[model samples]
Target: MTTSSRLADTPLAGELIRGALEIESTGRGLLPHRLPAWARAQCADGQLHMAESQPSGVRLVFRTRATVVELDTIPTKRVYAGAPPRPDGVYELLVDGRPAGRGSVPGGDTLHLDAATGTAARRPGPAGTLRFGGLPDRMKDVEVWLPHDETTELVALRADAHVEPAPEPDRPVWLHHGSSISHGSNATVPTGIWPARAARLGGVELVNLGFGGGALLDPFTARTIRDTAADLISVKIGVNLVNADLMRSRAFGPAVHGFLDTIRDGHPTTPLLVVSPLYCPIHEDTPGPAAFDLEALAAGEVRFTATGKPDERASGKLTLNVIREELARLVARRAADDPNLHHLDGRRLYGEDDFAELPLPDGLHLDAAAHRRVGERFAALALTGAGPLAARGRRRV
Candidate 1:
């Protein structure tokens, strides 16, 4: 069949393959579905909702095609106070509404899955790809499930298909990096990650370089961004650097400058946004080595407390305020020569308002509601030309 004819025939062609299912927790109340696509045509309304009232926790199911495909789950690496302790269990992957694979995420580890084996397994970071080699060529749906777990938070779900290729020329590619929050922490699905959600919302393709706990101004990552092919780009930094105490003020400024320099070496004129950290109370003004509260973890609980006092400078921590100030200064200096460069305070996406309403359970990563808020703000800022940054080729540099 002609490509155009095939496109006419497959109504769901180029549509996202996976979506979220509402899972309930007695302790957490009704959990929201993650990454609901902005394209109404691509979404199935009320598809995933609270189904039962079991005390053990809520049992939720996703709706999707039946073709058997590989499934993988990414886990949270950084644990802090009030953070949900990683849960261990036999998580399930259901394809076309049937159990196609089963896997186990050992307690205190991230889980990965594939069709060859259904159960969840520990993965290195909040990123993994699932390959589904032998499936009906004209598949229609897909779904994934996480069994009851007190600690596990579904980050993302990705599926590979053998359908006709996407029209690459029609879409711009977005390259992004950030902390665990950007790496899909607390997000329910792979595409639910804020970057992914924003990309889908903006009708762009995405090359997600978000590495959980790996956004520390690494030269290699900067180089990777410099070399990658992207029509548009952005980097979400600061929070991770501050939270991890990876660098102090002296090194932070240089590192930020260098990272931007590397990216500019390739796409000198691409609209590049430098996003600072989102809202986190404990780290808002304190410095870090944001250590996990072992006491809470050992007790199978999550908590976040002030690690450094306001008057204490001996600890040499970088707070959100510090990062934000530095980032603004850096961008101001760079924008003088690089008009394409822009800076955005992460709170513009998830700010004190959100923190007040849907406070992060761990005081670090955003919860599902906060994720939606961030996604919406990002779409408005990055896509709609609503923020200070302009869209497409409007940059002078």
Candidate 2:
């Protein structure tokens, strides 16, 4: 395999970027997790544990000019043993604020999940390497965005030239939490996720807490957001709750209140916006445990279908419709005293009309083009003039 020669052969453990929490040192290299040790200790669910290790916004930032770059990593890639094969997660490389390269590693450890049984098996595998050559001969700022979906443990960073940490940009930090949509389930690349895209367009830094299948109104998640330092904060709710069938209308409302209450405990006056879920057609009027559309899979694509009956709503089961209504009411009630708190209908970002134009390819999560549209709309709708984010900037800074 090609490797950097001019740069020292030894791995640079001391020279890592600052986006991750604590980097766990391993015999092989470094594992970057979004969750700190304390927060991780509170959850027993395997899904949440796995999601925390995905490193949604983590990256390696530095300056180098070796004309060749190599990043070695061992990613815990998820695989459905019987389901269709998934594409390898991608890493994004940016040089001097310009797109430099994009590619995926060849192989890594795999978690083979059984679609029918809801069980998984860990299969050990070898580390894979990604290399980029022909970089400009002069030193420039470089950022290597980690994969959004896979659990990546960075093994080594090598470039033929010297590297140093890039200077911190004077930009607002946005801490956001949501479900799989925000976790970038269908996004094409790491930075291609809507939150990442929105952060770039809004000229802000991002701390994404978009846990896939794991944004289930967990108190620990709220506490994590409370502890993180950020200038702007948002929480996107609904789809995950409804789709997982994890809670009912009665519980979801109070759960949300408690979640926001914890965040407010830490960020008393931070401009906090509560966003509802995106336009997911299956769960809009119907309740869920959304099931895989086997028919679609048989037809050679993946999609989701709602399984809960509409009558289940009478028992307080949540649907996207119920969630939006409750969220609006809850926010309005709280906003009477909490002027810093605001609400945005998730549909506003991706509405019915938009769905008519560009349906969610999987019947649930937004596809690549949809991600771009939602991200651009979010920047315009939530970060522009008179928006809550803008208003906060005026008040705080």
Candidate 3:
């Protein structure tokens, strides 16, 4: 299964991949972005640009007979001030569409984030190499799943034998958009994220648009989803809006309607599920903009606390309780008219009782175990029954 070409000669670039909308070659690697160049041009803020470029659900697929496969890349790792270092991003190898092996490449530039100042600084680091060896001699389909949370740049890829793009899988494509919780905020690895887990369980290809701290129910995001090909779609709403204190109740209903309206423009019959926020103790009854607990940070702990007063709800400020109520009401009304539309209480996936058993560690995001639990619960709730995503059919909508 050996090839005659040298490592330098066989370096596969982004053109061999199918998922990325934009791929830009850098001095060290090739950066792949989820949003297209046209959509990216519409964005002016650096934060939004960075969030959309984090290659969530983007995978490099190929077929190879090589025993050894290698990848060279630079991953943009996050470094939060005063908090413990998070795990390195994972690159999962799927042989014939099933997980075969996983590896993490070390050495990458770090994005230093300061909670107090709400600013980020980049520090340069060396590129890391990922190698997967000891594969079967026969040719097989392979897919390299990029980090769900990190911004990855593909510098090069090499195989002992020839490698070509893997054949497409005839499976439903599930497009999902959400906030940081869906973005693998505290999850240990990329594949460990709930949506990734749910995608596998549901046996569907994934197109994740979960942006960390960036899901503000943006019109651009809705338009992007509308343009993307999806048989199933779900939008996890409310957490970012509530935690960021971005909108009041009055704006929430109309905004949700507009977002769904935009997505329906393209996917009129695609089953769409609307999910509310999970159980976050800090934002359940209290309103946000959630602030970091500086005292806990000084003690080398990352904790979130609501800054807005509980009485703010009467003034239209959002809380988890308020958001859940509004979202349920909105979805119910929409479902009454549109059969493809459905609603799921995020609490049903991770409710109060579950919280008492496996509570959210940082008062915001769920831990790895919680992620697994939520993912399994969601698979059962959304992928079964006479629900919207159960079977494809034209209904009276």
Candidate 3 residue-wise lDDT at 299: 85
Give the number of the best model, judged by lDDT.
2
Q: Write the per-residue lDDT of candidate 1 for residues 102-145, one digit (tens) a residue.
A: 55443234434332233334444333323333444454434333
The number of clashing residue pairs in each candidate reads 25, 0, 0
Candidate 3's residue-wise lDDT over 205-257, tens digit each?
77788887777888888898898877888999998998889999889999999
Query: In model 2, what lDDT does residue 158 have?
Result: 78
How does each model score on TM-score? 0.63, 0.95, 0.92
Which 10 consecutive positions of candidate 1 have the poorest summed lDDT? 47-56
- Candidate 3 displacement at residue 367 in angstroms: 1.0
Model 2: runs farther than 4 Å from truth? 10-15, 391-397
Give the Å error, residue 44, model 3: 4.4
**Model 3 CA deviation exceeding 4 Å by range:** 1-19, 41-46, 391-397
Tally clashes: model 1.
25
